[model samples]
Target: MRSAVVAASLAAVALGITGPAQAAPARTSAATAAAAVTSTAGGSITRSEIIERAQYWVDQGVPYSQSAYYRDPQGRTYRTDCSGMVSMSWHLTTSATTWTLPDYSTQLGSLDDLQPGDALNNVNTHVVLFVGWTDSSHSTATIMEEARPGTNARKTTYSRSYLNSNGFKPYRYDKVVESPVTVPDKGMTNVTAVGDLSGDGVGDVIAVEAATGDLYRYNGPDYVGRSARVKIGYGWDSMSDIVGVGDITGDGVADILAVDAENGNLYRYSGPDYGGRSARVQIGTGWDSMTNLTGVGDITGDGSPDLIAVEKSTGDLYRYSGPDYAGRTARVKIGSGWNIYTSLTGIGDITGDGVADILAVDTETGNLYRYSGPNYNGGTRVQIGTGWDSMTNLTGVGDITGDRVPDLLAVKASTQDLYRYSGPSFPGGSAVQIGSGW
Candidate 1:
């Protein structure tokens, strides 16, 4: 009963958000204002007081040594699961709060309707507190919670894919909320197309060819040879990895960010125009900067697009703010154990705190790390998936399973296997495997 409702609700969100309702807010300046509003809310603690409090608490370190886990009915530590950790945190923060919890099956709903304190359920497996979501498509989100198995209390990040895996089945919260879309797209396929094009906020099939310099976008509904092809860059070559979708240049339309393996050039394009070429520029200097770059999205709080590039040989990350494509702004180093073979994928909000955070996946080693903010000169980094299995592909950003904040969707790719992490709300650490083995 619980699963059936979550699947239906998310499918409805796909249809509604992508429909005509996503049009401009009656004015161009209004759109920019909307962007600003969205960006402002990206930070988890809105006020300096809360930010200071959070930092102060974290600086003191997780006080697990002084605390003991709440024993479940089975005598197991509730801290063993993600939701249990969150529940424990809530208890510690407020003397009034109790271990008695609400059923996650009923808490899922439109993200817009949720409050900061509300808890959202992810396919009934995990949970996280409500944090702000991105203005457009709510593609970006933030959550603060403890993550992983057999580990002490730690904050983690979650993305759209975490919830929407398995044909959006993983997210089953409440009944579908209805909002009429005003946009004139045909037969709901545009939602699928936009997903293919990279920024529609859902998990779709996308592939880029380095040899032919071609970009292919396909929907899960009909993935064959047919795909939207755009020739954004040149130099007779191969493309390696890609990340992010948005108006990187503050333009109203969405754009693409890709990396060229050979020259180490980071390219951005307005569109892939066959007649001519779209506006493209090379960002960053230095060896590893250009060699491997991944989009990190508005990291500097400047509202411009940002990129996190890793040196193929050193694994060091260079944060390049992109308002100035010509200069690529400032570069801040990230991560200590960087490796060339490691693949970095962007997750919305891992910490449950609203600020923009990123998830790094080590392709070679299959380890996962959640980076929260570029704060304190370099921000805070937490290692999550340092285990045997690694995750591939972030499906989308949303409360797929209905936890207040967005969760993440990951696929192994090799076997087309799907896995999910319920936000802090559903902390069982029991990753529910969905879909067929690819």
Candidate 2:
């Protein structure tokens, strides 16, 4: 059961703060911020990033104003008003108004075609950023927009039917792109984890090439295709496993923990800075006995993340709780007879219980089973899939899809193809190949 893999230690954070709509302050004078850029290169952005940028304005309580402009951290200036919020969220090179915003987008046929980061525009009336549909029929949606009155930048749950009937057209940024996917050229010998390591609100992959001991961070797959795999550091092959524990330090960036293969010493690497990691700090020792380790978020209901590991000798499963980011607490045996599984990893909160859960592939049967969180004991496991032994590192990739739920990424061992598993949850979800030739 003990195998070298880059286990996802990140918590089941759905784009972190992306899940909750931020509260807004009353309308105020336009806040001025420098660093806005207007260039062709500034227009390109991922779909998930669009929503993230929209959330930034909502979280910042930017007031609505057609005349005033503010520069975002990315160095893009936009009006503080409705269309301006859309422009800033889209990172459009030019600040467009409601009437002009449609010029830069492709009009959707109906509200059903609306997506996160898409906009519902009504010319001179007003416009709002489409978050996601809050209803099955897609008539109701969650939106982020800067409007007039007391609340300026705010998130709203509104009626799409009303907007559509009122002449609000769904517009998708013409240049908006889907996240691209890529795999390591050499192979899967490296330990890898996936999360928004870049803070782009889109999931990115981080891995250590075993042969060269090099750490590489892959940017989100761009729209046209290909994730830029840039090597940022060296000397990581010594780690037996790299755990991506999501934002454990409250920095809004995902942090990683690595296990020392030789001594089982654990070290913590803070969130990546432009894919460059700081010096690793030794967090704990004597972890050499864990046959396998992975993060299962907040399993103890303590609001902190938790971990699950199988013993090297007895195959007994144990859980470690944390007082903080590194839950390097004492292990509590939760179950036994787990050695029969070839691999185990975190699948996030697949049960929809708000707590992280575990996934295991049957060594002989190749079946995928879900063990719900908080002391994964008893026979309370659920069979989620059959013939899943082909996948390794069945790890949580966070809400990379921005669907407000946790999803997982796994590697097909035989083909080296990467796949994304998402649905309502694992038991209700299916896997789709995202990248291949790893």
Candidate 2 shows a clash count of 14
lDDT of 2 by residue, 150-231 (tens): 3346664444324544567889988887663121133433334546666676667675543366777766532111255777
After superposition on all CA atoms, what RMSD does each candidate show versus the true structure? 21.9, 20.0
In model 2, the worst 10-residue window by lDDT is 15-24
lDDT of 1 by residue, 1-438 (tens): 000000111111111111101111222222212221111111222222222222222222233332345432122243434454444323222211112344322443465454333444553344554333312223223443333442333222233333333111212222222222121111100011112234543434344332233344543322333333333334322333344445555645445554444554656555322111345666533322333344445656776766566544444556766654443345667554454223344444445454555555543333555556653123465545453122334443334454444444454322234455554221225355543321
lDDT of each: 0.37, 0.60
Candidate 2: residue 51 Cα off by (Å): 48
Judge candidate 1 at residue 68 and give its lDDT. Answer: 41
lDDT of 1: 0.37
Q: 379 in model 2: Cα distance from truth in Å?
A: 1.0
What's model 2's lDDT at 118? 87
Residue runs of model 1 more than 4 Å from their true location after superposition: 1-205, 209-214, 219-237, 271-292, 325-329, 362-365, 375-379, 386-390, 394-404, 418-438
Candidate that scores best on lDDT: 2
